[model samples]
Target: MIRTFFTAVLCGLLFVSCNQQQNTTSEQSATQATEANVYGASFDAENVISVTQLQDAVAATDSVSATVTAEIVESCQSKGCWMDVRLADNSTMKVTFRDYGFFLPVEDLKGKTVVFTGTAKREVISVDDQRHYAEDAGKSAEEIAAITEPREELRFVADGVKLQ
Candidate 1:
């Protein structure tokens, strides 16, 4: 009787341990899958921009189309949901998805080429937010303070962005 009871307990413990390990592995796999699918379906920059240009196209049918491609200069710390890309003109443009949807790792986007379709509007960021952004961009205290006052600048809310 003693031998049987000991054997039963040992088998039960092993089964529970194995079950726990399986559950952990499954959870990790699910997390990775979720991450992989977070960025929405991959799209070409041109297609994304085409939809954004519809309004402008309608306004002036003969107007020449404008498209922009730039390197990601900065990204949101929380994720790649928002980023600022440096244009060929040496201007930085804020790029966020339409309706504030979806996110990506901002750090992963730095130095990447991103093509986007959107309208660029001039906006003034709050001083505090400006300081924070400057710091995040690796600016020194003196550099940050010099431009602490709100400044108007162009910002782009992209309908779609393709990173290369």
Candidate 2:
């Protein structure tokens, strides 16, 4: 019968439409999940400079906003509040979160490459602050006590950091 054929065709079309919609929804969810997995501030990697460039700028006493990509040598073990990013010559810069807003995962960041977008400032870190940071890094008591003098270093306050 013509009616039977038409009804079957309509049902087939409806089934196909529903299947396609479901697939689309599933794909969107997966994409969103992947994007949400990235940590820190969202940053464009194109303008990122090398750690050596940042170091040179610091040596020249240039305080400016910069994007630098470097390997994380260490992170604060207590709360992941800060990290030490390494330069090409094995120098390290301390990176802290902006406005105390966000912290990285302490254990998961070591040896990972990250792009930081923020300002690098040259400042003297006091003995107390150095010892506190050393303790937070899980350093031994002797190591913490070794921080007896304030030292000038490059400190970066990152508005956003993206793991590469």
| Clash count list over all predictions | 4, 0
Tens-place lDDT digits, model 1, residues 1-164: 99999999999999999999999999978876754533543444453343234334434543233345677877877545578877545667666676777666546567877666656665678888778776766677899888747876556666555565
Off by over 4 Å in 1: 1-44, 47-67, 135-146
lDDT of 2 by residue, 1-164 (tens): 99999999999999999999999999978965775634566666677899888888878876978998899999999998999999778878899999888887757578888888989988899999999999999899999988899999889999887776
True-structure lDDT of candidate 2: 0.86
Q: Looking at model 1, which ten-residue stretch has the lowest summed lDDT?
A: 47-56
TM-score of 1: 0.53
Residue pairs whose backbone atoms clash in candidate 1 = 80-104, 80-105, 80-106, 81-104
Say which candidate scores most in lDDT.
2
Could you tell me how far off, in angstroms, the CA of residue 56 lies in candidate 2 after the best superposition?
A: 1.9
Each model's lDDT comes to 0.64, 0.86
Query: What lDDT does candidate 2 reach at residue 148?
Result: 90
